[model samples]
Target: MTIHSSHPFLPPPEDRDPVRRLRGRLPAPVSVWTSSNGPIRGGWTISSMLVADGDPGELVALVNEDADWWDLFRKTRLACVNVLASRQSRVSEVFARVAPSPGGPFRTGEWVDSAYGPRLADAAAWVGVRLVDADPEHSGWGLLVRARIESVDLAEGRIALQHLGGHYS
Candidate 1:
């Protein structure tokens, strides 16, 4: 007996630079992913989040493995992905700061948590999601996190936040 083998239209490995290819894509909307670690906690605003699955409510967020929030997320397995409004640009900046810096922007505000997740009283709107799964592979640092939507709170206005050129506007 003989078996037949066929190769499909597979791109060469050298031609598949996922990071470079993805970077060329336009910047995505930014959101603050908040997680708690007992007495110590932090949150980072990122634009790399993507909706993984819609039926069971799954998502994928590209968070740096070295990010301060990564460990907290790993431990607690819970977080709030806060979608900011156009007027909340300042809040976005606060969470976008690099780690290991004292007096960073996150220190300048009064932050609180809600049933959905952390809430910036001044933010235009926000939502909470419970982390379900995170898979980090070799893709310039990322985690495929599945979360369940807990709640959504919209401020008394409607505005969309956008990110471009490594900045929020």
Candidate 2:
């Protein structure tokens, strides 16, 4: 699978480097990362995330430095990673800023307040995480954020959304 980077979600080749063709071959589950600074909340689509085995448990996620949610996440030092269902592509789009969503994106999904932040009620699963560290210097355009998993909520669901070849698979 080859993604030309001209793929709608990405910028043209000259303007933006092509996403690694191999990345399209490696399918990844779609998820939304949410953060709040008390009065305001924000979220965005994220595919660059993974869990790492450790004593206290941890997860790493790459967040675009330009995103407003990134700043909010830094201030809050907490977040919720919502593993999305296939039917929730629209939810993903809203956060990714691919489509317009009235009343803001949060209104499009059911939300529950959590110790770390907001959890997607209908997400396949969710993890509450507290920021452990952020390596901006080595992260390039995205901030490499490492977090300690504080909690997890699992729910029954089939058909999870996966990203592959520049499109949802």
Candidate 3:
């Protein structure tokens, strides 16, 4: 007799993970990570990432286990992090799957295939990385991908696109 759109097994907002709630309050930079396996290309908008400095700098990120970009990234073991500028939220929305694309997300913007992966044509800052390790992380329901920084291109400054409180800010 119950008619509703929400999944029965899905937890209510009040019952969700507290850790995730806390993390959501922390503003995270928004960027697009793109990868290609031969001719197959994919990109994803992401805000969960970190950088560790050492002999060889390492980039760490959490990715959805069931995304096209993740598939290409795993196969190629390479990616390019295109830091989205404040004025590029539309690009982010396209890659995030929150906005519709007539042809495809890639068609929304210009890109250049590089040794690392696909670079947003006008990305102010970008990083090329080679996969180092990937581990399963279930708490947030994502894979933890760690990569070594192979190349870095800084044109202007770090991007200002950010995500917080379950919204872009």
User: Candidate 1 at residue 117, lDDT?
Assistant: 43
Residue pair clashes in candidate 2: none
State the TM-score for model 3. 0.83
Candidate 2 lDDT tens digits, 25-129: 788889998987676889989988788988789988777888878888878888998989878888888999999988898988898777677788778888888
Candidate 1 versus the native: TM-score?
A: 0.69
Worst 10 residues of 2 by lDDT: 133-142
lDDT, candidate 1, 72-124, per-residue tens: 87777777777777776776767876433357545645578654445665665
Ranking by lDDT: 3, 2, 1
- Runs in model 2 with CA error above 4 Å? 1-19
Deviation (Å) of 166 in candidate 2 = 2.3
Candidate 1 residue 15 C-alpha distance from true site, Å: 16
* Minimal lDDT window, size 10, model 1: 1-10
RMSD of each: 12.0, 4.7, 4.4
Pairs of residues at least 3 apart in sequence or in different chains that clash in candidate 1:
none
Error of 1 at 49 (Å): 1.4
